[model samples]
Target: MKRIPDEVLDHIVEICNDEAALVVLSCASKRLRSRVACRQEAWRKRFERQFLQSNDSEQKWLHQHMRAKRAATHLGDTTSILLFPQGSAQFDWFDAYCERRAVEYRWRHGKYAAHRLTNTANVRPRGVRLQSILCAFDYSPAGDVAVVSQWLIASPRQSAWFSEPLYWGDMDTEDVVVLSKRQSDEYLVIQAWNMLVDCYSLCVWHTAAPHRPPRTIITDKREIPDVSLRGSWLAHRIAHSADTGQYGAAFVYDLARGACYSDIQGNIHTCCSLNATTDRMRIVCVEYNKSTSSPVTIAYKLWQVAPDRAEPMQCQATGRKAMSLKQGDIKLQRIDDGKFILYSRETDDLDPISAPTISLVEVVDEASGVLLKEKWSLGIRVMDIRSIASHDLFSIQQTYDKWLLLSLIDGSEVRRVHFNCWICSGLYPPDDQWAKMIDDSMWWNPRDDPTLHIHEEASQELSPAAIVYGHDDAITVVDYTGCMHRSEHQQGVERLSIEIRNRRIAERKHLVAEDKRIAAKRKLLLPEGVRMRTEGAHLRDKSKRMREEGEHIFTESMRMRDEDSRVYDKGKRMFTESMQMRDEGRRLCDEGRRILDECEHLTAKLQEIRAQIRALDST
Candidate 1:
């Protein structure tokens, strides 16, 4: 066997589209692996372009054929209705009759006119010929039309077309510009025969202009990275900080400037959300230790953003002043003035009223720590407390005035209730109506047999649990279900679903037995286990039960098989129909061309005869 030349092997690898073949070629030799990896980008681009072109061509042919048939059948002028409210809800809603293209927008109160904004254009011919529609509509911060991008068909034959400029106006000026042929950041549209594949252009139009050329910013194609608007910011867990003793980082993205910053040193664990107050933003981080029973701890940190500066600086720790609180959760709500209300949860101790159960700390400065103004303790029975929302702390006059939702499990029944913090204790008696409501809501009924499980002499009983409310009235029940029941239910469901599936298999086997008799006369091999009828008693009994409940047991399986068969038949028919149509179209086009040629020849002969007659008359 002759060894292939290096150039030939390289060319084969370059043209190879199969991933498996490429993988094998990469392992052929060290030089081949390096060559393939280096040229991966080129191969990827080539494959993507080829795949997109073929896909677009098939899609375009189907669309154009369908549209032509629809247009020929329906004879009427289509109108698009642009509806704008007179005075009530300040918004614009467009209703296109023929194409069913619609969009709604809310108007800025005084900035733009609400009544005189209705505008319509003759889009019937355009819509009929349109193969695709490209739309980009986004409103600016002040409720102004920041951009509107659209592309339409220009002719009935669908041979030529143009794209409209990004319309930027609302109480502002409007602008339009014609697009060029070459692909650029300014304006360039590419059509894959019928469908507009892509439009890579930047049209910057201001709101204060009725007519003007959009400022164009062009860059080389190579310089543009594969950056999409839907792209996500990458996040990875780094090593734990030795200084702050936590595992986390701060993620900040500057949308205006298109830059991202990550602060790993600040010991940030969880970033709830961004606060848009000053240049700086706020993020939450958790600190924990394994030795403590309640090992998990949480804290909030404030970071300042300096646009001129490269990174955000940690200004201060807000939860530090509430030293008694072990930072279970912290919620920050911005209120009047430059102050923020901080709700921090502390460990509950007996004598709930005396012990500091919940703390509403006011953040003054990062250096000074938290200033605790109000403290509340429900009872010594309460073990843990957490703030549901930031507004929960500041809005309530008394700490107990806020509702504390709790979850309780009394050996059998699981109970969840939203009770006033002060009323959670048995000592505080409620009104007759409220008392009945509490009793009805409380767990009085048991689910499973209580006598089934005998408590082990050595094992300690699980403690009662409570629900902690977050800032948004969101409740988090601690250990909602005991480990035993949760595992039991999960296992039961898995077993049940599997048992039903197994029964389905048995029924299918029984059906195969019946099918085998029909095939036996045709001399087909009997599948394994199909002829065996009475071998195992247990298996026979199970199969008997399965046959009785076969309809319900194998409903899902039968449905799936039926769906598969239907899809296969549908695809086969579609392919056959498409091929038949294509053949008919080709034949018709050929016949039409022949007829046209005959007509042309006859017209030429008649014109020659008329010229001869004219010459005879003149003579």
Candidate 2:
């Protein structure tokens, strides 16, 4: 294996069946070790094959991974980080691959640290699980997001965050989180529901700079539900013409130049579903043909939207139609630049054989509106299609009890997790659900809306908490990013959990005492001769039982509180130590970042100098 040429070796490593064989091969010789494990090309291929692509700089992420391994050593979980012997460097590509692989496994297994939502103008999240999710708005697959019980907006592989500020506290359930296709993670459209106008006012926010105010993009008097923002262009639903009764679909506009490419008021208007895919879009249209009985048809057309000046919107049909849905649900989302994936169920209700089908189609024949590339995922009771990331791997709420990760690659359910709410699968219930169960009424402003199940199907179970957990509603923002920034906060979750138990016990005691007093007063009111001796003895026995129960509860509360105190003291000491170490880590990380930046600058400078030297040599 070591004697093979580098070109042959690269091919061998890329085509190697699995990582285990590669690890064993890497141990065979120093050449194998360098080529298979330490080299950039071999590891990059493995990284892409095994994990969700990260937008973070590979070098920076490598350093972060190194920091995590060091942290795990500090926390005494030394065995897991020791992937290889002395061979793994601080920022080796092999180590980077391993970290990403572990993170992916963390996502798959639903391993995460749950933190409650706090202010930044924020307190650290308390330890409790919040209610069920209404909707999740994800930025990337890296798990860097902000989740609210009202709505969920999550990302993956980074820290997740949500806020409860003055304005954002009012965003309604339908105003979804919209992320741009680019990796800057900037240019997300978050909406604020204005109840007075009964409309949603959408604003563009640079997600990284949350402390700054967002620039409002549109403020129409309607909640335009189907809005898509990609790169520099924005498309949404516009108001229809009142007099003509024509359909209305908002046109794309560039915010940088403040240019509107198409105006819907004067020209092209249609009741078509529109979603942006990079510089273009896949437009699906339905036409009702009068020639045949019950003749309804669906057609797919490519809609190319450019920032350059173009003629006003023109309504032109590519002139083809496909099968009409009798009763199930059909969803169309962008798979990439020119492709569209259609997920459909034959029946809305659950059936064993009639599973949801995913099709990758293009407008090859404008006549058929489909070039069928079928990938079928067989499942029952699919509640809704939540979000679809880049690789055609979509997340769906299966029976409203679990989030299943369905892949278009093999048309199978790759992973399913019951704990996390969304695609990133980072949000989870508190480590100790009862212990961390919180009363969040203080900040969680409740609204008197219609029923809880708004857009999706109503309750499958008749009870609310089964599908939509609304009791003790507090969210524990989970961190499965594994970047080593797990909060070593004090034992607030345990202490708070015990505190709630005590409150309930005290309330029970007060109610019992009040009932006894009422009974005694009523007996006195009945004349002294009317009171039976047997009745008096029975009342005495009941009072004694009540007293005994009260004493037991009091004793339990005392023991729990004592335990809570000891836990608090121990947690405080550990927390203090962890915080100190965390500071030291941050200081080191900042220095490392500076060095990396300098190295990048120097490398670029060296390249420029070499180019100049070549030019002089030519002269």
Candidate 3:
């Protein structure tokens, strides 16, 4: 392996897509280390391809160094969404890429510190410590605690001025209405409804100006419609109901400029989702055809939403007929120009025998009609798809138990969580260094590291930066923001993972050796020792027979005493206590058996010691 030329090895590492494998391969020799360092250009390209591309250009993450370069090109008007809003330093592209992998490793293993929403908030009470659970998980569900809909969003170590908890109380279905991705530090969007007035209000609460009243717009609807937030715009749609002659009007509200746009949507399904961006929005619903004569079909409809209008784009059927119950949601994303990806998880009665339940469909809305081009099965169910903070990776709650980080660009699974814990996305920490989005290419060994041993716990996704978990008594906030792009932490962690892997291998070998030693001990006890033990067991059989007879007599006597001695209840407590213990005759016989067993053990030990001595003398 060492004899390979440096030129060939450099290409080998360049082709090595796995981060863990690359890091391990780098340790193979000095030439490989130099080869990895030389391929910084390759790392930068891979990093930019994975981490830099978001749906809209506004959301595309830019590093500080890239910002400077773009600033020069744009005549100092350099503006783009920051990959890590909290991060200030300029990192090497290779360093950023590797650090991004380390951060994913933290997510794969569920490594974070969790304080309750209350504890992480401003109201730090004296007894709040009781609610806080501190540990790296083994993936066990924190005991079943009631789900808290209330939330207080603030950065860790916000100064005394921002220390007070921003009180956002419970919603019937409490999901935070995101303001601007950048303005998230200062303002938060919330929903406040007046049941009596039947008016729903979308309000923006300012943290710094807590004394001032919130700027709000009244959503003129009886019930809250399905709302989706992206950047500064909030788009919501009411489900189409035929009885009321409602065509399911969808509304897009620009929370930034106080402008509203509406369009009459045709029959938006109840269980559909609306994905929004600054420029455009996409909504999906189950397509139903009311024809008793027609065959049963399971199909869904997609609609492209403009600022002024909405149009149903296309309808694609899963080629499945559900005779029984089949219900789930869908997620939509526009990858590139004219290209879109749809992930749908609808139950089918014949799914287990047919194919995987979740469908990953890549389509293009072209004049040539290519909506169902490349569809693949994910082998897991999708609860929600979350963009990992720093990378182009997306986290999917696979089952009720498992969570996986998937490549957002290609929808390929990167790293899966160690424990089968179910985590719901609560908040996403900043995607600081998720620059070049791809999975680390290490051979996955679940029990390789103790830090990754997790139990099946339930948590939520807060942000790409942090994980919010609720399993037991309190809701916990698990922050993974530390490993976002810390250079000091990155190499050390990769090295530590290697160390842990080696240590686990050594421990397994030690266990195998111990098993062999025990096997050898059994072999030594096969012939003469077995005969002696058999004779000893034969002698002890008489003692056991005597004890059994005595126990039977005691049992019969106790039964007679209970039935007949009810009137004469003297020393009844003592007699009952005596029944719990062996009688004197049985106790004596048992003591003799114990002595004989000890004698056999001592004889065996003596023989082992003498054998060892004889072997030493021969040596």
Q: Which tens-of-lDDT digit does each residue in 1-619 have in candidate 2? A: 5468977877787778567678778778867776676456667665554433321222223434555455445445545343334456333567566555555445433344444433322332332222212222322211223323211122221233444332343344343333322212235565445444455566655533433455676766544544665544566556555556665555565655566654443212232334443444334432333243322244433444444327434443343334323344345665543335554433355444433344545334346443433333353444456434333455666554556676656657754333332233322222223134333211110111122212232211100111221112233333445432222222344355468768877887999999999899977876763556667888999999999999999999999999999999999999999999999999999999999999999999999999999999999
Give the better candidate number (1 or 3) by TM-score: 3
Model 3 per-residue lDDT tens digits across residues 1-619: 7777777887788677676678787678756665675566677787666654443321322322343334333342222222222344233465556545554456554454433443333344221110112221222321221222222222331111111333433433232232111123234444444444555566555433433455665554544455555556555555555566766655666665567656435554432233455556555444444342222243545555454544423233223322212344334444433333445444222434443444444445577653544444454455555444234555665566556677756668665332222132222223432333233324222223333322355444344334445444345454543423223343456677778878877887999999999989989878878899899898899789989999999999999988778745757877776776657758888998999999999999999999999999999
lDDT computed for candidate 3 = 0.47
lDDT scores in order: 0.35, 0.46, 0.47
**TM-scores for all predictions:** 0.23, 0.45, 0.45
Tens-place lDDT digits, model 1, residues 1-619: 0266666766876777564466566677855654455453464453333222122122222233334344433433122111122322211111011111100000000011111111212232343432322222121111111111111233342222222333333322222222221111122221111113222333333322213454433212111111111111211223244565554454444433445566634444334322333344443333434234332343545544455655454555444432233444433433322333343343333342342333333334445563323222222122334322211222222244433342111111123333332222111111222234322222211122132221222111111111111111111111211112233433455466568767877887899997887778545533434455445666889888889798775897899999999999999999999999999999999999999999999999999999999999999
- For residue 399, give model 3's deviation from the true position in Å: 5.9
Model 3 spans with C-alpha error above 4 angstroms: 1-41, 49-91, 108-187, 196-198, 204-218, 240-245, 256-258, 270-278, 289-301, 305-360, 365-399, 402-461, 468-477, 483-619
* Candidates by TM-score, descending order: 2, 3, 1
Evaluate candidate 3 by giving its C-alpha RMSD to the native, one decimal.
Answer: 28.8
Stretches off by above 4 angstroms in model 1 are 1-247, 254-258, 264-271, 277-280, 286-300, 306-311, 314-357, 364-619
